[model samples]
Target: MNTPNPDTPNRDPSDDDLDHTVRPHDPADASSAPQRRFDAEVIPLRPADDDAPVHKDEDARAADIDTSFEVQLDPEPGAGPEPVDDGIGYLLDDPDGDAYPVIPENLRTLGGVGEAIARHTRRFAHRIAFHAVRTPRYGVLALLWSVVGVWRLGNRQLAWWWVSEQDYLRSLAVASGDSREWYRLHREVKETRRVRGLILAGQAFGVLAALLVMVSVAPWWAWAAVAAVGVPWLAHLGRPEDHPIIVPAMTVPRFRLLNHDVVLRAYYAAGLGHPDKPNQQVTFETTMSRTKEGQGSQVKVVLPHGKGFDAAVNAKKELASGLDVAPSQVYLTHDPSSHRRHTLTVMDRDPLAIPAGKTPLLDCKPRNIWQPAPFGLDEHSRKVTLSLLWISILIGAQPRKGKTFAARLLALYAALDARVRISVVDGKNSPDWNKFAMVAYHFIRGTVPNRAGDPVRQLIDALAEIKRHIIDTNEFLSTLSPEECPEGKLTEELCRKYPKRLFIWMLVMEEFQNYFELPDQDDNKQVAELLSFILAVGPSSGVILLSSSQKPSGVGAGDVQRLFNRYRDNHAVRFALRCGNRNVSDAILGGDAYSEGFDASALPVGKPYLGVGYLYGATDHTPTVRTHLADHGDAEKILTAARQLRERAGTLTGYAAGQDTTTPDRDVLADVLAVFGSDPGLHWNELADRLAGQIGDRWADVTADAISAQCRDLGVPSVDVKRAGVTRKGCRKQAVQAAADTAAAS
Candidate 1:
């Protein structure tokens, strides 16, 4: 149970009553059931037969006469005008369209066609080799079965010619003492045997004739061919039905096309419709058809009048069960034309197994950070791209599910652009992020000190530097002319002109949740504040924040917890891979994604499913992406090239350049308490005078105003204190001691 973030001064007082995290209890009562998720609330279905509910018109609701069109408007509006109909009795605004494209979407691009060919080639070669390896065994089985087939065929012919079954029937009649039946059976058997004997003799003569022709006119190879064909036939006949001499090297599953009956039955079984009820059965507004690639079947389904897409989505698992397929194979994409309409695509096989192949970065070519980077492919084989500019990305998953790899991928993308300054911070101190140090300006690992200096202090320094840079960039942009900065934001041209000043900065934090729960309360809060501030205002300043967390919830208590949740939820884009449960998935992707039925926890389980997840808030379609794999070698190679690019561009600095980025001693907390002495409290002027007197040269420039602001940043509160019967603002020794202890513990 998480609470909403603390309100700012601008928040409405009345809005305080809206406690979204919990249910409203009766004023006179104390307890209430735990808050229910909106999706869990059962929606009442209007199963009665009724007319279709009218939908709101889009064009009517749109404000068409905006600034560009206001002066050139053809008409004005008080209430929206009625929709005009064409002469042929159709509303021109509404057009019938097919979701399927003319060309196979995956084949529209050269890469897609090449990938398809390569995939098929790989599959074909595998099948060929698989069968080739088992050829000798197959031949041995055929020869063994053929020898038995010869004796079996001869015995069957002999029995047919001798009328063996007729003799048995005659004996049975004789035992029953039926003379008439025995006489009839004997007459039929005698006649049948005579006819069968003549036919058998003719078949032998035919065989002899065929052999003589093969021995004379036919070549030796022709006889071999005949034997080859005849041997397999004999083997087939001798073998049991279950056992075959030859078997398929690969299994190809067959899928039935989705027609009206199949689609309707699935919906009815899922309780979305009633087949026997009048006007309550699910119907298809458009004809059923195969997907562009012919890999699956798709249909335009419309639920009963009262039921919308929600009903179908909520019952998606049930629908998959009813259709006898895995839930991952069933995709329900909402149709924008109608609330009742949604497209259902049922795959023939598990789609998660489809490989996204390696990353395009394998070529080690530089990519523009402004353009969307090639991330991976969706379940439908559509390419998914990630836009790194002006957006903060959050990656969350259970440990060992490729959470670190996902964040590393984005960092590697930004690194390719030489102008992007990179900072790599690995809280868990894993080797997965080690390669990133090649391109990072500031690289820090774990909480303890390393060759890179103290990790915790270095991280604080990196964040503070980024925070200051953001403010500087904003101030510079504010002073720019419209011609210099058209969108009133950082642009590629501007950054290029002044690379050092405007170049993009990317901060990669792996296992960031560990920082939030640091043993030191003040350090935890300081890190949270700096990160929260940077995340809220960094993007417009060309700052990119990429944070990965295995534990996104329950990191700390009170303000730290609230800030962590707020910061985690505020990311512009989130990619969750193999979350432990729906709650974890929701925590990563937000509840809106879960409501839309894209649960990361539902991702197929297997080694192949690793690094694959639900990518939401990045594009219009929420795609389950199989992220492009970048192994350790790949990361090293790509990042080495990135380091060279930065060197060539004269963009290398900070840790990469071995510069001394150490900040001066910032133990302001310890200094403040030293000045306080044994006083219960003091005015700002009194504290500053005592610090100057006692601390010597260190506090020579310290002033009442300077110490007042510094104390706030150090987490020490100032208060009105009385000294010699005069009251002014200052801090007490008790508060300073607690602050120092908290910082020391972390």
Candidate 2:
């Protein structure tokens, strides 16, 4: 309501005598110059009185205009200034909320209750026995500490009294402001002194009474009780909290309790969670202690949304660092129940620090080849078995890494099965497999040279023989009705029905790379092709090929390398021990397998970890395993046992059967004649059928044409004969006798 000042800046002009529209002064009009234009100002107009007189002069109206209006410029139009961000605080919330469950460290697994009880009892007994052995020393230390405690009792009590008196004097100083309170404190302090004297007198009297009882009326057994219980208790009270009087001989690793905070911290440290977001939402399901000889803890974790076990496994090193443990001491495995869940095992010590003991195959019940054979113990010290029925195994590692030993384990188990026939080719020609020759149906020591031919040629011939076995087995399988082989593959029922006819043939080729890179290109190519064929088709026909090599890739021979890759692909089960680098690990396991964390190159290289390796393609998760060690003595014992079992069952055949070693070069005429005994008059078709049934499956390709050509080469003549209802081309008794005589003379 007050009138505005014209001299003030930024002030609105008075409404009286205000013009609604004011234009700029025209340069042509001199009188317009004195009239100020207030175009920038917006003023309200007031209605004039009804009786007011009107003035027509423009100069008079313009002289009342105010000049306080000024134009205010605005900023240029463009992108607006970015908003000031006070960062989101919810993202930094603590991840250890009650929303997630807490898993204990002793109740994770649901099955194997019996095994768990047995393991716990063993550990408890061992710990008690270990501590009991040193009880005498601990007892002596306890007695010495008790005597020292009695000597220091008086000094300790006096020091305690002096400290208490000092505290009381400080309280008196605080209450010095009030004269009445100061006098009251003096009386209280005198009473405290009297009470302290009475407590010290009682302690002295108690000690005197105990000594008097021990020397006079108390029994000798009472003294023993005091020494056993009283001494140790007193010693414990005198010892410091952090530093115990007695130190344990072994250093036991302490596992961090599995709780929400520990798990979230681990997830964040492993880079699986972001600081700008809530810690990866995890559900701690349950936990279990390792039910084995080793000391460790197991935690089952259900990962956050959109996460998987592979991510957890890939961050294994980070997790171990977060938990303040070694990488070898932590193990991450997938949960069988859910894809989003995983089991995290943290060990107190490396399980591979000790060599694996002998297997229990000799003591347990006999296992058929159809069932998985126990190979070794996994990283968690759980039994690991492998199925050889429909799979081939390729073992690769550096020298002295237990490549031969692993292969021998497979062969030994196969020999124990009465229905399984083993063929061992020790390419190194070492005595490692010499004992196996006792039980192997077809055993060839490649270390020894063949006097009559090239060694490589002999090796090639041995492989060819295996290929022939595959063809024969296939033919025999074709003759069986669908009822016998429902899946058109070898079954255990069929194996038991005709144990001699349908055998599980296992071929163990040690140093197999040598055969594939032979100097003779022809032999190398032939051996490669035969081995590839056997690996591809042998499993279905009950044939297993276990091959070991020091080098897995980059062989000088192109054909050999190609064959190696082919075999590697077909070998569904593979084990790689302490390799030199990632390249060798990937080559043996598979591309990306090493990156996926199944790194054999990470295995420790020493006698204790000699048989340690990463076993892949055998289960859903890759596991570090220590294969059982079976020395020469163990091998001989196993072979002797297996041979005796085979002899009792009448299942031994081939070279193991003690047959003529010269049968490899004998003509078909002599073999057929041997089957004939006395009767030699038989048709060619009849001869072929008899050979097929007698020689198992190797002679399945013996047709009438093959028979007539071989008979003519052996100087055996064929004549027309009448049999049954028609005359057919057949051999006469006289002609067969002449051919046998000629073969012997040669």
Candidate 3:
């Protein structure tokens, strides 16, 4: 086929033309010079006046010359048209004539040059037509109103020259011959309006009136008036030079375009773009993409300013309305200017929610006293129900996971609920549980009593008591018909009459493995019964089981499975914090639920996962992760209140018997008896004088002891210790008893 002429009009060239056109001086250039040269076909593209320079001769020469002798056709479509440069560089392999540049003047020859300019300009203008009009409308109106007002106020006249006086306004004021001098005059005018005018006016007025006496006083008042007006004007003018216009008053067209460009750039980057740029308001869509799997894309709209906060909030509200999710799930934040740049992030999850009017009980960090238990439990009712009904719950956490805090919160919650009664079995006597001792019906620090003592018997007795209480309460509930009980709340009278029966009792065993796994085999058997009672009948009697294991598997899978079985069908509430074993998490609820319940990747030092129905298939709601024991102080306060209650109720007898260990000394008794042996009754003042050295100032202690151990035992009925207050009669009875004891011993 004949070679297509690259210079021929309407003749498209091949790739060979493009490759050869870029080479330097060659044989083809010389050979083509004599035959058909492509030089005449070369099109020299011109740059705009403000754009970069173009070297036409060099480019043309480069287009015609070829390095090899073998001929190659022009790669570009030389004859058909010219190409367009869109800022983005063009690819050489384009098949469409759209890539070819059309000659500018030639286009006018074919059509109208004016039309193209007008068309492009119209398109560009229309692209921002609404914005251009909308953005400046408010400012333009405000400026127009100001101008009209100034015109109406005769402000122009105030600066106009008076022909009658042959004086321009400048003639009365000051004059500057040149532009530089005019600016200098501006300084003087400012000072005149601000500071010197009134004084000069007053001096001139004084001269006109010939009133020397009034000059200073009038000037002072005039100056004050000028200052009052000028200061406000200056204040109005005081602002950053770049931001000279007031907010809501000034319009920033360029900045707005910049903002628009930025938004568009972000949208494009996020793969969101509008087909029509003109005639439509900018559309903002979420950046999140949806996929086939449950995992989907989400958009995080970063608001630019305070106004942006309102936008974000509104956007979230609109989304929530559309999505049917609560507004709380919508997170609005001040994002970095770029992903890398800002530290100031203000976020509002719920913009419309009013704070509930209750103080948290534990009132722990961030959480209030009444705030739901962190780690897992969220509702007091659920925690109380579990305590009231569950046999045992195993709380396993790594250290500092707020396990103790959760326990304390649970205890406080039980204390607050009248239907539930709590008793703690702590081996370490963590100070957190001490306060609960008063309100807790039974607080056993191991069955051993004090540390190092035998806790096995004490624990067994307490467990037995707890079992008795559980059985009794269930029996009582069995007796009452649904009609007899309006609400299930048990009152103190009900508990008093049926001490073991009226309420649901919670027995919290801390470090239970220590007690249950005791060295003594008999003690171990006792623990087995305790566990059996909790595992078997506790749930039926409103006895919920809550225990903690450092290792659940270590406790035996049978027990774990048993617990799983009990709670699997009906677990009311369950929570765990920083669990080490994934198996445990799976065992509790399942790996999926654990992962869903807790953002384990983001867990802080003490945060925990709470699954509502994890222990028992109770509810499908995602468990709210919370820290344990909202506030330790609330636990202490409850214990204190319980102590006060016990004290008021004369439970003092129990406490007194528990701590009453004072015994009289045998020697002191013998000495007191020596003084009173001669007389059954004696003068009290005389006896005090005689025995002051023996008993010190606390002689009443001696007297009281004598009355209690001596006089009462001797049957000295006539000499009543309360009425006669006879120290001598009581001492005589002690002397008789002591002498008798001495003779018996000898």
Candidate 4:
């Protein structure tokens, strides 16, 4: 086999030995359409360039797993060719590949099952309504067109009986001045017309007899069935050739079910191969098959020998054109097997356009923070989740594209898990994040006071606390023996055991750039430095930072800007929702994402596609997700449930409990109310113990009688509380809450 180096910039003349070889195409199989070829036999094999990057030594070439391109097999007829590559490959047995999964991918997870049901159900119901609304129109058109069909059918039969075509023939004979010939032609025409007219009358009589029987002796259903078939036939024939009686109820989804022929044709049309030139024809590295989720098709494609993967990547648009699908429907994933190899996936429909619907957490179930949070559905309708442990996330997009909503959705998931401590900070003073305060330990709206005091200073102090917490938590974990803490990491059990000391902190910053553009340059730099440090080290210590920004670029001057850039780029996971440009999308998802064919800017625009974006660095597959939506009303509901869970577990603390977190507080009513939570009442002893543990040093030495006395002085009443087996004197939760509210109102 002769090979030429595409990188060498020059061709070798010795490679043209078979230039005159002409492969023939059979004329009998010619098609009306010139571009689509369906030849059953393979094109005659030419010299196989196969695949060689700089003509590797025979030994290395022999190790390649794919050997489908063997050249002139059995060089001599029925004789084995001379051995190359040390002849070692002959003795080696290939390893068996892993078997395909027994169960389908979508049915493997409960979330996946739910997503599939919801997606298909919505689609089916929409189609039902679409056709139902247009039924009246269809009925009217059928009746009108059938009348036209009756007239047309009679006219066509009359034309046939009259033998109208031979009238021209009779005239021609008359014009030639042949009276005998004209008479003969006229007689022949009359004979043909007589036979045709008789046949036509018989057909008309048969139809009338059928109708008469259907209307008289036949069942009523039989007459209806005749009308059903007969009416459609008339409508189809009588309607204008350019128009149709029935219109499509919906725009049919584009793209075809993929097969080898379909994939090969796409590559060929994209200039990756030539149908006639066997040497230049693209070859498949793997069979094209349905993806695991059964929503799309995937195949490992190797461009013709000399071409590299970039050749296919650069011609992506042409490839989509060939497949006749939107460019967004084509996904290209690079394969590590070889540079010439890349996986091509073409979806049956544009996945990004499929809406994922509302968040499942709307049910308000208490979720486990240790597991991955349900984020959205992927291109395959598989649930895409985000694991917040040991990793942080960044959300980036233009305004009104659901950037804030995407970030808040994750925070809400964390909120539902009672063990997770949350801090909500909105730099732009947006009301969207205000409801999160119900579950947030530290809530800040803006630089100035809107909901919380001195938002910048409060956030700075919160960061400082988080940094201290990270150090303290790490030190505590180091002290535990391997038996107690085997992995030197936070666990769900441990977080439950010591909810106050080792917290699962989630810091949500919405439109965070405003913090770095504050009037005080020093404050801007300070905020930037603190957040950057937290983003770097907090995740490992159980603090997950979720920062969202509409303006990810052009924030501050000098070090502040540099620090901001570092903070923006360091997140382990990034979700970009409809960014303004490719640069912004790259900034959010990173530079490599666009190369792999994911650009948030290229996503379809419109309200329906809101919350749809590329979720990168979160999973191995960077899927374009339609993130679950939780509007303000839904957010309030979920967050209220989260707060209730925390109150029941005795984990509510800081601002959410009305504690003066910036300084020390000794407010007994607020403290007991925070510890009281969802219980109707708590015995003084239980309340005292819970307060001591949850509120830390402030209540460490407080006694049951002391708290009871404090509650009574604040105009709170005592009530009878049932215990394990006996009744005890306890303060009612409502009484403490009323006292706290009264004090605040005063």
Alpha-carbon RMSD of each model? 15.5, 24.6, 33.2, 20.2
Give me the candidate number with maximum TM-score.
Answer: 1
Q: Which of candidates 3 and 4 is the stronger one according to lDDT? A: 4
Considering only N, C-alpha and C atoms within 3 Å, which residue pairs clash in candidate 4?
A: none
Which 10-residue window of candidate 3 scores lowest in summed lDDT? 339-348
Pairs with steric clashes in candidate 2: 107-287, 108-287, 429-447
* Clash count in backbone of candidate 2: 3
Q: Give per-residue CA lDDT, model 4, range 8-46, as digits (tens).
A: 346665553332222234333333323332323222323
The true-versus-predicted C-alpha distance at residue 330 of model 2, in Å, is 4.8
Alpha carbon deviation, residue 31, candidate 1 (Å): 67
CA shift of 614, model 3, Å = 10
Cand. 4 Cα-lDDT? 0.79
Number of the candidate with higher TM-score, 2 or 3: 2
Question: TM-score: which is higher, 3 or 4?
Answer: 4
Report the lDDT of model 2 for residue 262.
Answer: 71
TM-scores for all predictions: 0.70, 0.65, 0.39, 0.64
lDDT of 2: 0.71
Question: Which residue pairs come into collision in candidate 1?
Answer: none
Instruction: Name the TM-score of candidate 4.
Output: 0.64
Global local distance difference test of model 3: 0.44
Candidate 1's C-alpha runs over 4 A off are 1-99, 144-243, 256-265, 276-280, 305-308, 336-341, 353-357, 448-452, 478-481, 554-562, 601-608, 648-650, 664-746
Report the error of model 1 at residue 505, Å. Answer: 1.5
lDDT of 1 by residue, 1-746 (tens): 22222244677765544422233333333223332343322222212234533224534223221111111112222323423434575455434344557777778889989978999999999989998999999899988888888888999999999889777888899999999999998899889999999999999999999999887899878978997999898888788789988788787688755667877778999999898899897878777777665668888888889988878888988999888888888999888778888889888777788778888897989889999988888887777899898899999999888787778778888889998898888899989988776777888889877775677767776787888789889989889999888888999999988777788999988889888887667677778888999999998889998989988887888888999998999999999999888888999999888767688888778887888898989977788888998889989999999999989988888888877554556477787777676787778888788877987445544557667766776778888778898877888778778878887898
